[model samples]
Target: MVTVQEQGDTVVFTVEGWHKLWAMRSELRIPRTHILGARRDPEASKAWGIRAPGTHIPGLLKAGTFYFDNTGDNKPTFLDVQHRENTVVIDLADEEYNRLIIEVADPDEVVALFGPAAAT
Candidate 1:
């Protein structure tokens, strides 16, 4: 399952896959995917200095930095570093990234699937 926690100024989201692979360990190995970032307000995007070519998977996995502005006017602009990247650049602000995170079984699962040191 995916768990979200807020500690001070940082938000922690984790995906777990313990139960997801219980039945199909042979057919499916852990899946590696990108986690996207998003916000409800346009101003938030601007506040965070988020432009085009948004945050990617590799960067997120390596550095843990994600694009997040604010959903309100004069939102706090900052780069959230939650993970790092490897190969591809998956914009976290895009809908596709949200979809992937939603479909994942757990937040820890996502880390297991895409963490920078997973392959190594």
Candidate 2:
């Protein structure tokens, strides 16, 4: 699981446990302005076409970077989700990752951080 913490103008995502190895990094900091919105999307990583530099264990785990080949845009995604049911898709702009599909202990709290206008 991951923990979301808002610090000033940035939002941090802390990857916990062995997920740190799977994701290749322990923390990610994105400027609050770069966060377009967020939503609870269990199937957010369902169509991830390739695991470029990440790890996946079928229905068990999907951590690291993935690309959406079907979209042509090849939208890059960073995923650290163990359970689909507790995933949140956070859309971003002008950032390294186009989106983040991660599992948080309380999805509601994370979504609320972006506010109603930012929740799609």
Candidate 3:
């Protein structure tokens, strides 16, 4: 699981508990402009693949920075996620990560953090 925070003009997502030990990364931070959209989607996990540089145990766990592919001259994108269900799928742009998929106790509130202007 991860914790999301709005620090003034930026957004920060922090890894917690055992997930920190698995991912080896503590947090992801980016400016609000880098966020394209956010939503709750359990299907996001279906995209996980073995080629990605990360840890996984089938339907049980996922925690790491994963590389799916690249686009244009933009930095190669990444996917940082812990769990699939009850997830907050955040679409990113102009950053090293193309998308962020993380599971939290409350998916609805997490999605609401982006407000109505945010896309699903």
Candidate 4:
């Protein structure tokens, strides 16, 4: 399970999962980075057009929460994205799963990163 907590200006993400553990054991480091102009599920609510935290996909802004299949088994992974006061929250539940958190200055940056036709 992923848990997100806020401490002053920083956002904390707590991730826990078997796959995450195995991956970290193999690599000794978690892969984290910002992704830009990535695709989103059509069925997703809120349209998630803003750049949010992600891995591999560059230019993607780290906004709200996101979830993906980390085990390559086609099963859904758990994630949480929330906003508290001036802070944004991201939480993952799986130690082996890769997670990224992006901190941007304002909404304009989010739009610039994840807006349609934005570069990857």
Best by TM-score: 2
Question: In terms of TM-score, how similar is model 3 to the real structure?
Answer: 0.80
Candidate 1, after superposition: displacement of residue 89 in Å? 17
For 42-117, candidate 4 gives per-residue lDDT tens digits of 1222223222232222222123234443334332322222221112212223443323332222423333333432
Sliding window of 10 residues with minimal summed lDDT for model 2: 111-120
Which ranges in model 1 have alpha carbons more than 4 Å from their true place? 17-100, 103-120
Q: Estimate, for each residue in 1-120, the C-alpha lDDT of model 3 and write its tens digit.
A: 888888989998888887886766788898988787778878766564443456676678776766543333433333445556677778877777667778877888877877432543
lDDT of 1 by residue, 48-92 (tens): 333233232332211111234423332221222222121122123
- Per-residue lDDT of model 2, residues 1-120, tens digit only: 899998999999999999999888799999999888788889876765678798998889999988876544556789999989999988888888888889999988888887533543
Candidate numbers, best lDDT first, in rank order: 2, 3, 4, 1
* C-alpha lDDT score of every prediction, in listed order: 0.27, 0.85, 0.69, 0.29
Residue 72 of model 1, lDDT score: 31
lDDT of 3: 0.69
TM-score computed on alpha carbons, candidate 2: 0.91
| Error at 96, model 1, angstroms | 14
